[model samples]
Target: MSVDEVAALSLTEVAHKIAAKELSAVEVTEASLQRIERHNEALNCIANVNAEDALAQAQKADERLAKGGPVGPLHGVPLAHKDMYYRAGRVSACGSKIRADYVPDITSTALKKLDAAGALEVARLQMVEFATGPTGHNEMAGTPRNPWNTDHITGGSSSGSGSAVAGRMVYGALGSDTGGSIRIPAYCNGLVGMKATYGRVSRYGAMPLSFSLDHVGPLCRTVRDCAVFTQVIAGNDPDDPTTSREPVGDYLADIEGGVSGLRLGVPTNHFFDDVDDEVREAIQESISIYEKLGAEIVEVEVPGIKHGFALGEVLGRVEAATYHSTWLRERPEDYGTQTRNRLMQGFYYPGTRYIEALNLRGQLLSGFTDEVFSVADILIAPSVPMAVPTIADTDISANQGFLDMIARFGSCTRPFNFLGLPALGVPCGFTGNGLPTGYQIVGRSFDEATLFRAARAFERETGCTENAPVL
Candidate 1:
């Protein structure tokens, strides 16, 4: 296949070609490297490119293929990691200047899983500083521009993961979600982003902004591609005691099951309020499509939805402050403006408030399960309240515009993290302004397969998965 053809192929298709001996692993790796070189300057997506290591790994994969050796499911696939994920010898800056020179001695469990699955890590993508903010703005490393529009923000934390995947620089990439890091960018850049149940995917070696809310998942071009990546990475790990002992389900099996007879809950109050008219319309249209596919739409109230965000904010801030306390005290100037301001605010949160927030989580979770799931199998809402905004439009000075933007964009997503549910952002339709709008499909705890099935069904019915940014 030509470089263009190879770059455009999905992860599943690439794996098939490699397994069939129709495409060499080196060919795909080289194509991805070349594409990164051509576009990274303009997009500023890739923070670190490991071309030599990737080629070496690719060569080994090709040798294994020639020997007819048993290979992992994703053999010879080229992929990237979010810069925040540690890779042993590589520096994990976490988009902060403080850690720009700090290198870890262990690789992230997520990266290890991808590597074991026969994926070559070609590069590390840029992200928001300390994964704190939602917009892709980074004063130290530079912002990752959206592939759809050079002027628009790429969304945050998982910023480069979304941009690179959407721009076809790599087949897929791993991203961490604290609030909405994964889903926001996924929606803004026209890709699929899954925030697995908090403990479903191990967080070992990935920089943590909030211990209770952090989740690692894949951002890819299609739902099946995300599933393929997730299947390789989701499971118990000895290193991460938080990882559940429950067996990982067959994510790809029966994924084409139509949404017929599935109960999809639409939260009428918190999720719909303050959403853009275009995004609201797109989400309604997506629900209608699912209903036409034999799914039942029920209006259900997600009890404590607003309170979930507030509690998440409290816990996230406290945990983040705990992690960065030493550095924050000693090297305060090394941090970026947005990250510093956000982390500092944790100092103001009283001990009683933090404990109260933690205590409230259980009650909120119980209410959500009892009230919401009683009526619906999965909850659906808009991923972001508004379309992708221009980088110039946001004030990164921790001003009113910046705070308001974060609250609005993250309003629909933060609640899920607090509830510890699996949530996915899938491209459903485009706004009248030509930007992509995503619908969030959330499932019960550890029920990512159900969410994936619903997302895949909607994607197939709408035929929007194939749409890419004009860039």
Candidate 2:
């Protein structure tokens, strides 16, 4: 295959090729780096391109493989990540001016796991300021333009991860989701992104947004790829006490198990409240496909999600303000205007409400899961409520309507974050306006395998994923 073709290969394809020695780690790394150089200016999906370091790592991988050592599953596959994941000595901007020159002294457990698995990280992707926004806008670092249509938003926090993966500059990217950061971009850019059950992955060495809500996950082109990446980076971490001690299942093993006979829930309440015709139709089409595949669709009264977004907003803002209290107080001028405006709201919230929200989480998770999962193995809903909005339309910095638009954009996703359930964003179809949209498959806590099985079944039947955004 040509260099561009090599660069465009998905994560599993790249891993298989490199593992078989049909392609060298150097070749894959170089191909991705070349793609990044050619396309990054327009996409701006990456913040710091680690050309020299990546190539050196690639060379080392080649030497190790040549010596016939046990190979890492990701050996030599080049990947990029949102700027929030810290790597010792590498700049992790977190898409904020305050951290513009900050470099962490330690690497995130997730990155270390990926590194041990032989994934070569090629770049640090862009993000919203302190990962505070839902839209891919960062006035301090500039918003990353959508690869499919540069005029649109790439979705936020995980903005660059979506852009880079969709643009075919990287195999996959690490992204954090507190309030839809991972899924929003996955929906907008047409990729697969999963916010694993909270505490499923370690948060050690990663930047904090909301200590209670932040989750780390991947954005990839397919369900299998999402499963593959998640496998390597998931499970217990001594550094992170919040991490689940439950053994990491082989996500790929049962992925092809398909969704046959599984009960999929469609919430009759909150999920579809503001869903547009196009959004509703695409997801319905996916549901119809699943129905034909023998998956049972059950409509259920799934309550509590209605309160999830607002509760998450309160917790996130309060925790964020607390985390950045020093920064917000000391370097108030460092944050983007929109981020500052948003973060400052945390300060005004009553501490009693924050505690009440925190205390209510377990009851909420219990009630919601008991009701929904009791009737369904998985829950399916639209990832984005409306058609993917243009960057200008969602730009809170420029538009007056964005205040309402932001909440609506995250309406479906925020609840999962609050509930700490595993949710995957699967690209099902494109909107009439030519932008991308998808359905979210939320699984029971620690049951990401079900989410993958269901999504992979849909993907196989529909062939929804697209490569090489029309940049």
lDDT of 1 by residue, 108-179 (tens): 899898888899899989999889988888989989998888888889879999899999999999998989
RMSD of each: 1.0, 1.2
Flag clash pairs in model 1. none
Clashing pairs in 2: none
What do the candidate models score in CA lDDT, each in turn?
0.90, 0.89
How many clashes show up per model? 0, 0
What is the model-wide C-alpha lDDT for candidate 1? 0.90
| Native-structure RMSD, model 1 | 1.0
lDDT string, candidate 2, 241-319, tens digits: 9998988888988889987799989889988988899889888889999999989999999877777778888899899
